[model samples]
Target: MTLFVDMDEVIADTYGAHIKRVNERYNMNLTKEACRGGEVWQQLPDHREAIWRHYFEPGFFRELDPIAGSQEVLRELSEKYEVYIASAAMQFPDSLKEKHEWLDEYFPFIHWSKRILCGDKHILRGDVLIDDRSHNLEHFVGRSLIFTSPHNVNTTAFERVNSWEEVCSKLL
Candidate 1:
């Protein structure tokens, strides 16, 4: 099967990184639970632009930690299926290079040829798409697996998996 996986939130800990950076920069103690059911910027309405600025900052994508168990599960899945990292990277100019470096450090098994750094997901053709955003999966003509994020906990539009372990149980 051709499995196209999203980078942010799904495999990369972008939510956690944003929270951590925002807390340190703004001197606010915001937990993941506090930002549940919405984006981090939504939680910090006053610092919305500041929070969004974090993504555009240098090394933002490079410094993100991997979602727990994602590496192992993805490596296993790569052995069984044709895996690809499909990320909306064009929005951020630095993300293209930083994401590539991040993947090399964490998921080196996923080669450059398999990485789909595109602006829109509608152009992708795959058997399955695993992403955190419902919009990305909206036009996807495949099995949509919604990888859980703090912001998307309340979403019920598609099949949801809270952890990489749950993903393994379903896909592997």
Candidate 2:
């Protein structure tokens, strides 16, 4: 089976990175639990722009750490399925390169040939799609697995997997 996996919240800890930067820059205490069921900008309405700005930063994607168990699980998955790292990276030009490098460092098993950097998810064609945003999964013709992120906790429109272990159990 061909599996398309999202990078930001599914494999990389972009949500945590955003929260950390926002908390540091705004001098506020914002935890993942507090921002559950919503985006970081939504939780910090006052610092919405500031939080959004983090995504456009030079090293934002470069400095992000991998989500727990993502490397191992993705490696295991890659052994069994044709896995592709599909990310919506056109919005931020810098992120395109940074995300590619990040994936190379963390998920080296997924070759450059399997990496797809696009602006929209609608063009993706695969047997299974694992992403955090419902919008990406909404129009997907394949089975959609919503990888839980703090921002999408309230979303229940698709099959959900809170952790990589859950993903392994469901797909592996």
Candidate 3:
């Protein structure tokens, strides 16, 4: 089986840093407790790019701390399936490179043969797509898991999970 995984919210807590910056800049009482599964983006979809650019522009990929148990789950999954990364990050090539480098450094067991960066998941078909994005779930026909995010709501054909451990349970 070949598993295609999303990068940002699936493996890394992409909004953790963003939330901190938002609080600092706005002086609002934005607690991490306020981070629901789909409200963040709903609140400010228009500012998504700008927020990412400001908070995640430099060394963001390199600074990506793996979600707890993510590395272990990927390592275990790699033993059985060909795990490939297909992030939605089509614009920032440098950030994409950083993601690859970081993955290689942390999960050295993952072979280069299975790694890939694609703008569209439909173009790179996989047996399973573990992504946080709802639109990408539409393309995956077989098994699919939607990693829960602060911005993913109206999605079907994808089981939602809050953590990598949950994903491991579903996939394994």
Best of the candidates, TM-score: 1
Best by lDDT: 1
TM-score of each: 0.98, 0.97, 0.84
Candidate 3 residue-wise lDDT at 136: 82
lDDT of 1 by residue, 17-102 (tens): 99999889878899999888999999779988888889899999999999999999999999999999999999998889999999
Tens digits of per-residue lDDT for model 2, 25-119: 77889899998888888876887777788889899999999999999999999999999999999989989999989888888899999999997
- What is the C-alpha local distance difference test score of candidate 1? 0.93
Alpha-carbon RMSD, each predicted model: 0.8, 0.9, 2.6
Error of 2 at 144 (Å): 0.2
- Candidate 3 ranges beyond 4 A from true positions: 37-49, 153-157
**Model 1 weakest 10-residue run by lDDT:** 43-52
By lDDT, the candidates rank as 1, 2, 3
Which residue pairs overlap in candidate 3's backbone? none
Clashes of each: 0, 0, 0
Name the lDDT value of residue 27 in candidate 3.
69
Which regions of candidate 2 are displaced past 4 Å? Answer: none
lDDT of 3 at 44: 59
